[model samples]
Target: MDKSSYAGSPADKRLRRILDSNVGLCREDAIWALDYIRKKVADGAPAMQGLPQPRLMKNYQSFAEAAMSLLLSQRSGPMEAERLRKMLREALHGLIPD
Candidate 1:
């Protein structure tokens, strides 16, 4: 994949950081979600509105699981992609906690 295709822009990184902090998705999943959410924003739907509301349940485990699965399902050969998959796997194994 092109670096730009998966690489987060500055804004994407910022948003990803927030997701990592609050939603607690690992970097791999969080960044993927950043890309996904950015695409959603471009398609006229922001993932999060600034409305203050009660916290709803978020499934960080599933998010990370799905993101890693998607990455692996791509059958990528790049070292970075493989490295990222390992990182996500580690995170899923509780290497990194929210």
Candidate 2:
């Protein structure tokens, strides 16, 4: 569906439900919540107060590259670093629309 309709659709409600859930939270959930939140705001409300601004993913590869680049720049230790990378990959690869 179109962008405008997507903002108000039942899919949006289902997304919200997923977001509201207490368990199984992940980067993908946050990404979708952020996206729909932005869309909802653009549909009427004011800009998000403290939310991270969304960057459009050019493609899956670009999204992957960006995440890897960010993680590399951060230079965390192995375990935390791996988790961060996984979260970013899932968020970008799974949630982002091509």
Candidate 3:
């Protein structure tokens, strides 16, 4: 992604820090967690009052892969990391209904 976009953004920097420092779960666990979330969304679970349901529930595998790719790419630096993160989000947002 474009590192320039996030260069001076506080929110992106905070997100990068959080992504960099957070830990506990392993890859398999992360996959399981994502699967659980997908199942919940696919089952027609309501989002929080103001939030919309995720648009990519049916494409869970792709979404999960993108997430894992972002997590596993720690050495890619903040700009690339942000790109991956944005890619994951955009992949979710870009899905069209069947």
- Candidate closer to the true structure by TM-score (higher is better), 1 or 2: 2
Model 1 residue pairs with clashes: none
Q: For model 2, state the Cα shift of residue 61 in Å.
A: 31
Ranking by TM-score: 3, 2, 1
| Candidate 3 local lDDT, residue 41 | 55
lDDT (10s digit) by residue, model 3, range 1-98: 23343344563443333233232223443344345445545665443222444544434554666677846765555555454444444443322111
Q: For each predicted model, how many residue pairs clash, with residues at least 3 apart or on different chains?
A: 0, 0, 0
TM-score for each prediction?
0.23, 0.30, 0.33
Q: Write the per-residue lDDT of candidate 1 for residues 17-94, one digit (tens) a residue.
A: 433322333445546553554354357443323212331112234445546666566553454444544444333322
The worst-scoring run of ten residues by lDDT in candidate 3 lies at 89-98
RMSD of 1: 13.2
Distance from true position, residue 64, model 3, in Å? 5.0
lDDT order, best first, reads: 3, 2, 1
